[model samples]
Target: MKKITIIASLLALSATTFAQTWSVDKAHARLGYSIKHMTLSDSEGNFKAYDAKITATKPDFSDAKFDISIDVASLNTENDMRDKHLKSADFFDVEKYPTITFKSTSFKKVNGNQYKLVGDLTFHGVTKQVMLNAVYNGTQENPQSKKLVAGFTITGAFKRKDFGFATEAPATMLGEDVNLRASGEFVKE
Candidate 1:
């Protein structure tokens, strides 16, 4: 009976190992996107620094775990003036808040190829629950890096005012609702 129990335990452990997990390979990962400003065309940009970790029970992503960290101080809008404006207290307040982050609170498979990701997003100094229309871009192995990687894209909007961003432009200029797009690529450690 003891031997049988030990065998069962081993099987359970091995089964758990079957769960696929990927670590963020910063060199190959991207954490960025932009939104339309002035109700005109979308302005493009990206975060200079970020990391992520994701785990999937299978490629379908029915069962998964996800988390990401972004250095708020790394916001680079390309233009020196715009980047300075974004880092100010009127925006992200890089001096006060050095980092912004998101961690999955829950996940649900909404459809065959879509998912609802519920997570806490921290910005400025406030934490808010944000839901994302997420997509599983699937998984692959990089022959060069020899690392297993998984990718995802998340889209949502946030109230910059909620995080005390730009006290001056709550209604104009920067706009209150900031569009957010996160694309992450994680590799197996």
Candidate 2:
């Protein structure tokens, strides 16, 4: 009984040592998206307020979990009038849905730095499954902050209609696909 208790304690300690939490460095991170504008050009925008909660058991982040949130009111495209319109009922409807969130369902490493992340994205009061291609930029000690940091780039595309996002423009004018591209820096907590 004594030997068994000692082994169980050691296993618990090992699990605790491997668990880690990471907080998004919002100053060094960005959550952005791009969509076809008038079917002629790409209109790019980013959210100014957002955060990512990350937890992992391995440094490679193969088994990492992610929970991210973005304030809908923080959407910016460098055009004031258009930005306002985007926040109205015709688009994001920031008044009713102030935030967009994502929670990871699975994270699987594909290659050295490439991974496939499956998650549920909630936006515009609708929740849908999404798959994102993620590339881990690896972890390093910050020279100035002296804290451990990890970087990752995530890219994916989803149909806006799937999330109940509809606009006045026709499909020919405004594309249905919303492409998401973001790079985030996380500080060890």
Q: Model 1, residue 117: displacement in angstroms? A: 0.8
Clash count, candidate 1: 2
Provide the TM-score for each candidate, comma-separated: 0.82, 0.92
List, in order, the clash count of every candidate structure: 2, 0
lDDT of 1 by residue, 1-189 (tens): 999999999999997888877787667556665655666666666788887777667767777778788887777778989888778766667898998888888778998768999889887788999888888788788888777777778787877667666667635345557787777677776
lDDT of 2 by residue, 49-148 (tens): 9889889998789899999999999999999999999999999999999999999999999988999999999999999999999999989999999999
Please give the lDDT score for candidate 2.
0.93
**Each model's Cα RMSD:** 3.0, 2.0
Q: How many backbone clashes does candidate 2 have?
A: 0
Query: Candidate 1: where is the Cα deviation over 4 Å?
Result: 1-19, 33-36, 41-44
Measured by TM-score, how close is model 1 to the native structure?
A: 0.82
Q: What lDDT would each prediction earn against the true structure?
A: 0.76, 0.93
